[model samples]
Target: MAEARRPRAIDLYSGIGGWSLGLRLAGIEVVASYERWGPANETNFKNNHHQAQTVDIRRLSFADLPDGIDIVVGSPPCTQFSFSNRGGNGDLEDGLEDIVTFLGIVDHLKPKVWAMENVPRVAPIITKELESGGRLHAFSHLDVQTHILNLEEFGLPQRRRRCVAGNFDMERLRAYASRLERLTLGDVVVALGQDPVCDPLYGLRIPKAQLVDHDPEPALNPEELRINRANKTAHTVYNAMPFPDRMERAVRTITATCTRVSRESIVIAPPETPDCVRRLTIRERASLQGFPITFQFYGATYAQKLRMVGNAVPPAFTYLMGHVFQGTDAEALPPLASHAEHLTAPAPPAVLTPPDRPGSVFPPTRSFRFAIQSLQLKSGVRFELRNRFADGQTEWSVDFYFGTSKNIIALQMDHALRTRLVMAIPARLRREVETALAGVSTYVEAADIENMQRVWTHKGVGGTRPFMLLDELDQAGKGLVEVLQSEPEVSRAVVDAAITARFGDDRPAVGLAKLGRNAPVIAAGLLIGSAANGALRTHHLRTTGRSPKTKSH
Candidate 1:
């Protein structure tokens, strides 16, 4: 019998070798890697024992890559095409150029199998190009076998979702899918042990805060201080909370932002504890991102390490994909039962106590919709109710809290709606409001009391004027509301149009103006557009500048 051939592969934009590691694990030999980042290249070299050429993909030629490569797998830099980049902004053009160049290489080399991984939004764009070029047939060796696989379905810990497109066989991918495995945050955390935590301030080794002599009541005055106190209380339960059931199926996408910095958008782990404010440490983050414990990143700063982890493909996810591409059945292989069993056992509980009193006034809930609308006429602070009733009817209300006083400045609403309000006031007036509300239950309506007081004093006041000072609140609230209300397809269209307007148009000034006024809108449009048919079409129009109505000769 003839010996089986070891598949040869090349990785482009191979940051820290996430895809490469996965391919390597599945018995694919990564002959060469191309990457631009120095730190990532250094780490990839150290861990993979493979020398990576530091070169920008745009400037490099197909001749520069290793010849006779059986497979080519990569994830191009997504920032230009990502939702975060001002709706693809100027980067959309650049992203397209890069994609074309990349596809050009693919067409020239005509590898037996090629896989490209990127954010889900990139799929439509790639699919359009593949179909137009007639490369899809050549790549897949068939017309109908286009594959797009999600990382979540394969069972990695983090909720990092990506789209995979390739010329790989469908039967192979199906076989790989049948043997998919899921992992949770706990599975990864416990397997790695407690010593090197993701957040240095709070991980496994650092003991949870002791409850002895701890005051649970929120502080009076200094609104920022109050918020900080509330956050601390929320953290108590978040840190000790076990991984939810859904988490086992997929992990949340680890973001670049610090977990401790923002109250409005932190991932809550349940079973609260005081130590929750700390961000995930480098090690824990790496684990969550599916990097092996043995894969070490050598970086001078924490930020550098974070970038490395964030950029890399989840190795386990990649491994499964690799097996699929190679036409192998992972399930037919003997089960690694002992390895699987080691991941499920629970660790001893950390010593931490929950706060007795209301540690902070604000409760973290997903149902809140906040907006700061500087309307033409009325613009105070507006919040939309997101809470749902059993009958599906929603309630709406609005309240204004005077800074530091804890008293309702005013309340206005037509009916019960879903929204809550928290006010931040200057520290000086806290005592007065505390004194006034001394005997009142925390639940009493401050707005009602204020209205009664106004009527009793016979002071006829017109509707309250909008508070100009709440500009930031209005902006943040409106942004949130807009995001919540937007349909995925519509949002994508707007983002795509914005990006096209900015980069594709000959009138550079107009694009620049749109970017200057509201970058987020453009970003949303691009993200949405990228996910739908419009983004690619817009790109085509921008590149070719053709009107559909104009007839060809």
Candidate 2:
């Protein structure tokens, strides 16, 4: 009797072989994988021994794949649709291009089944009818089902919520789900004082050197400390994370980008030095995502390796999917039970628990409420942001009030974005603003003037309280130097002085007379009237020999 040939499959966008390894474990042969990033493809090949092709998926057609690919699985990049990106406000047209390509191949190949996964936000976009065949909208004709699954339920040790759409049998997979028990952070990743029940293989993969604690985060950087603290609130005071992580339930989502600055990176206080906090090592992060110890990731930099690990589908969960696709029974493996040492360990110091959250989201001593309620530019454009600021720092829709339009939002912008917007202004004007800024000790931005008509959105970082952008739903002249509530440091005089110098006394100057203490130290914009705007444009056209772009205003 001859050995039975295993059903062949292909993994697209296979990052570190999460899908490939899982499917293979389910008795399917992952014959080939297609990825565009060299590091990821190289890692896939090294680990899984598949023919990893660094080909652009857009150019792939029927001829490129093997004749009989029983399964086609891929995760199109989720940057555009993810809520973490621009608060779910990314350009849909640009984001859907890759998805269109992925679906096109599935349509072309007409495989027995296919699967695609992405952040939960992508669920509505893919399922609802979109455009015609040239694009991927309205693919209900393909007959695939979409399931929004939480990895915690399937026994993974992190809170990973994903929308998986596939033709694989749900009933078979559902059966596998029933037999599995939920696992928590303590079961996998190492934490302070934990006697972990993590797989022994994980111990083998982590070097003894890697087990050493990271140096403590600087204690005095108040702003970084504030951000980390706010993230426990998760953009709201309503839902909070255990400060130094309780290790009781699954930890928060493990993002592709991990930093100590945001709560997404698991923070722990070493038992030996309880006050000092450090992030989980790379090996721990890998373990959190359900990658076994022996799995190797090849990359030039630590960042690249982390990206591969973070972006992967949890192989533990996928193994079940492989069984569903292969029409086979999954061996019932009981979830790891909690170890007594892990359950009884002492808590990390300082951050994890407080009946009430620490510090203030908005300055309690804000001067704006007592000062002026609103500020009007000399040109009659009225601006107001105090009410928003008074609402809370915990809730920032408009950190900088530009005007009254939805496109022009009022939100607290991080330093990087603030710098980028500042850099867009012409040098001469920039210099002028900077010179005046010395008096107010604030910033001058083209966002209120040049970017007035430009649509702006904020991306929410996972595990952090977002300075979520608030839509300015006022009249047409959206965004004004409204009496926006500001940091305690920004005084009424500061706003008045900036407005005075930025627009000069005679130009469309912002009048801060209405604001006092609470007035938002808005990085006030130059309120260039139509005539002045035209003059600046004309000057630029003559100076540079370029046709003027009519301002969208």
Worst ten-residue run, lDDT, model 1? 414-423
Residue 335 in candidate 2, Cα distance off native in Å? 8.8
Instruction: Report the lDDT of model 1 for residue 120.
Output: 71
lDDT of 2 by residue, 65-88 (tens): 887778899888888888777767
Off by over 4 Å in 1: 1-4, 87-90, 130-148, 194-249, 257-259, 262-275, 333-381, 384-553
- Per-residue lDDT, model 2, residue 138, is 49
Off by over 4 Å in 2: 130-134, 137-139, 191-223, 234-239, 270-272, 330-553
| Candidate 2 residue-wise lDDT at 384 | 30
Best by TM-score: 2
**True lDDT of residue 435, candidate 1:** 31
Please, what are the lDDT tens digits per residue for candidate 1 over residues 1-553? 9988788888888988888877876778889888888878877777766768888888997667777888888888877777755645636556766666556667677788787777776777666655645333233332323345555565566666676766666566555545655666656544444343222111222222311111222322233332333333323112222212222434467765432323422232322433233234455667677665445676555557767887788876777667766776655532223222222111222122222232233322223222223211111211221122222222212222111123212222211111100011123432332332221212222123212222222343322211211232234334433552334343343334433433455433322333333433333222221221122223324434652232110
Error of 2 at 425 (Å): 46
Task: List RMSD in Å for every model shown.
Answer: 19.3, 15.1
- C-alpha-based local distance difference test score of model 1: 0.47
